[model samples]
Target: MYLEYSSTKKREALKLERGLARVQGPPFHHCYTVSPASQPPMWALRRASVSLTLRSRGFNVGASCVKLAPTCCVEEESGINESREITYGGFLLPKTCFHSGYNSSLNFTVGKRALSSSSTKKEDDLEDGFSELETPASDGNESDNLLTSDAELSDDDGKENVAKEKEKTRRGRVESKLFNEIVNGPGNSVHSALEKWLEEGNELTREEVSLAMLSLRKRKMFGRALQLSEWLESKKEFEFIERDYASRLDLIAKARGLHKAEVYIETIPESCSREVMYRTLLANCVSQNNVKKAEEVFSKMKEFDLPVTVYTCNQLLLLYKRNDKKKIADVLLLMENENIKPSSLTYSILIDTKGQSKDIDGMDQIVDRMKAEGIEPDIKTQAVLARHYISAGLQDKAETLLKEMEGENFKQNRWLCRILLPLYANLGKEDEVGRIWKVCETNPRYEECLSAIEAWGKLNKLDEAEEVFEMMIKKWKLSSKTCSVLLKVYANHKMLMKGKDLIKRMGNSGCRIGPLTWDAIVKLYVQAGEVEKADSVLQKAAQQTQLKPIFSTYLTILEQYAKRGDIHNTEKIFYRMKQAEYPSKPKMYQVLMNAYINAKVPAYGIRDRLRADSVFPNRTLANQLVQVDGFRSNPVSDLLD
Candidate 1:
């Protein structure tokens, strides 16, 4: 009983050590060892034994180490060692219950034999006697050749076991880590976690890891997801697990901003089920804008007894329509042969697809198909069709759709408003646009308000734009982008005081003003010849964007200072430019040179300034500066003259 408790404690300690080893990596001894039998065998035995016991108890202690150990004796023997036999005898738990049913077996051997130069080398060396067999080899046959069969068999077994063990470890780690992360959060980098899994010496399986990564991507935590996916592709590890590999490649392709996903579905392993391979291939085809491949995958999926989902089929139709509506008709014919019933989404996809391809006639067929399917096209669907009509410049058709929608008891669906309002505004139906804006005020979605405000802005209806802007601020709480849009609208109308007020209101509302605000202020001041104020705004803008003021703006400020004969301010702006590493433009050089000339600076400084500005011959202002009269008396004279 004491022995049993000691064994349990020892097993627990070894488990803790093995877990530590997996996290930190194989120990220093593992790397420097000449042979597994020679390296700190005591530590390996304890750890391996503990892992064995824990695995026996179903605790998921990995099997790779134990599986790797036998491979040490798996090497091909030298020519002189034909008579030798290698015996590996160790405790491997039975496939049954613990202490009650357990019984020990001795003198076991793996089906391969190689030499071990230990003092106790024979089978009889065991405390319990076990018999051994010897076989004769022809004298001319080398010992190495005689041992070849054993070596080959052991090597094959070792590889398979090692691969299986490593796969288990990787799968265990991935499942546990993902479960923990989902329960908690992205506590550790998923890519780093995957890297650790990859390091387990397992045959790489892309599908399992890709699915894991795709889940992470959906949560917007794409950073590590992208890294692992790229690593998998570069290593060609993607071929082993090709099932969902294509689907994950789709995401990676999108994330990378590629025009198409660059994966060959045929490279996927035959071991993967048809459904996984089909979906993944279809997904990749769709992501890459290759509807032809998608259709091919769809057709081939049938052979695998894998039915393409309505979602995938819809995507294929879209791809066809986007690339060519003539292909869309072909897709419909294929779907009809397959007896796949089109859903509202399927119909919507057809309409949207035709709209994108400018296939108005094709869109009419889709409308007819929707009626045939007993699916009444909703306003949202109508709105999509309206957009198609709008794109075709068929305002009459678009207005008809909108008029039909208005005649219905429109329940203020923000989605419908977003689609319909733009069409109305584009059609010069300002009254209809205004009515939508009023509806948006009562059922205010952030998206609806922005769309309404933008549509009003397009119509140059400043009062209506301002009304919605103010209402958006009060209702949804102003975001910086929203406020910036309002500021831009005010600036567009040359409402300087109102723009200024909006800037102040932005601060009062606790909305951040970005570089846009500063640029707007500086531009207004420069246009108004309030260069002093413009320079002040420019200074603030520079601090915000961490960018040096451009030479043109600085030159304008310097021109104003030079006109007022404020040499101190002009020098300050010049030095500020140098400190900020602002590149001196030809216009800037001309402005500064003229400033020095007009300020009555010495002839030497005036000539040097002209030389500096004259570097660019096409810069007319530099030539004009030196020729203009009383440049020494008034910098303004150069401008006025």
Candidate 2:
């Protein structure tokens, strides 16, 4: 046989004695198994190989050209035979072994000739309005960190590294598929999205749900986030951890309201009471600045004999700091009484708290105590120290600490610059502010840009603020917040035309026009005495689905109407804000009530409505009024009683 002769000749030529087995099949079909005794030469590793001559009787050529399986697929009357084979270096393979349909199977590598694997991924993750891969699971995990030196990788090492890359790629594809199927579905509630999908035998794993929840929470889709959390709870699949309940409650409070979240919490079974839900509640209370409610919550925890961690105490400390900051001492005293040792977090908040006041000696003593307790301060601690130093008029000390932080490889960021820029701007040291701003411009983060804009805007340096805006646009696409800030700057400079054009540009660029943008535009119209234009903005905002204005925009209109003695429009705007679910504050109602009183237009109706709503007149509403009206004096200070 030609096969026998060829096998014998190959063994003789390469000195590789391989055992060859021949099987009987159709005359045209030849199957042979060759077991190599040793590694073959690189030239012998061929795949999808055949030994039959091109002149075989079973084969036919079209257009007088050879149409082998490698060159073309043979369409037969029987089941279509697709190529399911690969060719190594001139190696022979049986015809029937891989004469089936196509499948992406494994391919072994020869020396230096690496084959690329082709895999497909979904478009949902990469499409517009979604880039879930921007926050890839292994993003910023550099392979260089895992390497010891610039040494050449061995065969095994190369394969392993390739495997890891492929694994990450495959994981991204899976997550994209899962997200498109579940998260982006038309189901309003989490139950409708995932429950049916699982019941239909589709894979909806616990880890996948957890990842989806994290992404939703990060994206601030708290309504969908709450739904996912509730769905996860209903499934009773994974054991809910402390953070699970805490995060779910937090989302409920954020997406819905505190009362609704509290109602949801009360439904938690008594058996699931081990984790501290009170801690999350304290954090929310702190954000709300409800001193009385926070105190009551803490006291109730004491009455309930609930165990308090250092984190819980830290939340109470931040809450106290926002209110009567002097009460921060009471938090420390409470910690001491309860034998709760201060963590790094405790000291971090304390350092910031102490820094806010002219307590240089107090800060020194706290640092001494931290050292005494064997706690090395972190970057935040150092940053807080710099804040305290600058506040205490110790500029040199602040600069020296900044250098020390840099030496420690604490990367220069917006937080450090924000603390320094304001101090320099306050001291009228525009040079120092410029120098620090230059450093921040190199980073060009959104928050740091706001800080830079604030510095330039406060100085009334129109040219410099515009320069920063231009730089922000060049470095990255302008965000909604950036556009709003630019509009404010334009307003300050009396460049209303440019601001209007910028709003148009934002809309054209598919950016959501937020409440802030409308607020700025309305203020511009109000300043120009274009009352009808301002009203048009309000009407357009009410109708817009994407750019639906928040309560603040409506408040601006109400305040304007109040200033103009238009009680009818004031009441209508107030009602609209309430109907649109814009989270009405008592301050909003109080101002409108005062407007009614000033206009002498049945003030008792508004007053009685306020009383029935339990709206206690706010004292700090004048600050917002000052911002909008550009007033140096509190016009509505007489609104209280």
Candidate 3:
């Protein structure tokens, strides 16, 4: 027993019939729709005994019992087109009911409409049974119109529709197949899966390959990203552009080292080796705080006669801001001589540098200069200003600037909410933090939620922070960043057991515990007075991830050891940091010297060590050295005995 219906309507009807079959307690037989080429010959006969009870909207449509040793094929005479067939409770409608045109005398609609009627209770029950299926709500007239339209569609239109659907499915499958294979493949290397994809005769477009590379980079799978980049370049299917070369160069630097990246840059054609390529290398250098190498890259850019832009100058300013503030004036002079105007980032760097140096007057002068040049501060600039103001102990100024940043419509400028939450919390303005959080609560973004958690934590509202974290995990997958925020809160309040439980959850959930999570975990154990445990976690992290644990991870343990006057462990950790190739900074030396001072037993080779590391002592450090040298005459080591 078969019922004829269009493909779209057939899907809905099949779902409804399955539900009815389950309720009627019968073994449901599988049904297949006959295509045009497979239709039975006209006038053929078959022996069958079939019984069908048709029901719609809980109303009985009567029953039909038929036994035929010779059943005539009346499909052609009934005027039925090549529509598909579905079996419903072994029921077959009369031959005349299969007419292409609607039969008003039958008083029953076919397809989804057959299950839907004017009775709201029946409709509700049907919906409840098949809630996953989505069918449009329509009255009897609309359903009739829909069926008529389906029947009236020309054969050419049907073929075109199917072809369009097939093409869409093919395109989506092709675009995501390579990416999925690479991500879910067994090993770290994507080379094998990528090669397999090509061998499988799947077409690769430049857009598809480029998108895969971009996504890999975002995931920080630099090794896989570099492999994909190298594979694509080796195939030579697409001509290399400047940006493409630059992307590969950046990948090489990240996966390998900057020196290897430099070697690769030399292999690039001069046509592709333009300023953008050099700037890419320069940016990577600056990010690593490799001042000497970065300057060399800058010189190479000049030697190539590439026109220097404000972007390159800003990078130099940023580098100088972090290491060697004296070089900042030199970069500014170069920018002035080259007639390159300062960008917003350039001004912001200068402002931050001034603020860090505690030169409030200098920061105001930069802002004045920015205004004079007809450039208004952007949101980032305003946030930087507000932060410095708060740090300078000027709450009124920070509040005024924050209000201006909020502007006329706080809701419209939703981004400002994340920025303001922390600043308000830092100023101890609980009400302002609550107000900002309320606006975000309506439709919070991921980053805004993280900021709210951190802000609530800073305000010592553990319950509120836990509530937000709980709500967030239910909506989104638990990311390490989110977990790190709550962990930091627990660490600050010295909740060791809570931090340990979160770590266990992170492992069980397979969250990617990267450097940030490592930093937070280290801080957690350190704050809990388990310095030995903190040191062990750092060692384990170095072995686990390809990426190095961030500098702060080591520094946290070192600082704790320094406070305890554990000179041996302090020197050991400091040497480990140097072995990690972290650039020497004055703060590291100051902390090491503090360990000696706390132990009251320093008198040997401190000056030589500082000079060997190329770190100059500040006035305070100079005074400390003199005090430590005073220990030489007294010989505190002998005093300890």
Best by TM-score: 3
Measured with C-alpha atoms, the lDDT of residue 99 in candidate 3 is: 26
- Candidate 3 pairs with clashing backbones: none
Candidate 1 local distance difference test against the native: 0.46
- What is the lDDT of every predicted structure here? 0.46, 0.48, 0.59
Which is superior by TM-score, 1 or 2? 2
lDDT of 1 at 160: 18
Of 2 and 3, which scores higher on lDDT?
Answer: 3
TM-scores of all candidate predictions against the true structure: 0.37, 0.51, 0.68
What digit string (tens of lDDT, one per residue) describes model 2 on residues 1-641?
00112344333522321111132111112242332212121111111011111211123222222222211000000001110011011111111111111211111111122222111111001111101110111112221111111111111101112222334456352333444444546645557777677877887676777666654543445677777777777778777865577677778776676677677778665664523565566556554445445555554454455655555555555554333332343344334334456655455554554455444544554554455455666554665687568767888887777667556432333345654565556455688778778776655554466667767876777778778887877665556657777777676666778878988888887665656667677777776677668878868876874334644556667777887768888888888866765433455665575565557554534434644543432333322233334223454764642
Pitting candidate 1 against candidate 3, the one with the higher lDDT is 3
Return the candidate ranking by lDDT, descending: 3, 2, 1
Clashes of each: 4, 9, 0
Evaluated against the true structure, the overall lDDT of model 3 is 0.59
| Model 3 Cα shift for residue 483 (angstroms) | 0.8
Choose the strongest candidate by lDDT. 3
lDDT of 1 by residue, 1-641 (tens): 00022445445644644454443223221222243333332233223222222222233423233322221100011112122111111101112111211112011121221112111111111111000101112233111111111101110101112222333456342342432233233443544555555566644444555455644443333344656666666767645344245445445544443333334345556664545545554554544444334444554554454543444444554453333222333334334323445556555654554454444654565565456445676554666677668767998988988889676656633445655666788777899897876776765655566567767876789888888888866655555546555665665566778777777876786654444455455555655556778787777767775433333445557777777756678778877865764433334444555566577664245445544532322224435455543335566766888
Error of 1 at 1 (Å): 71
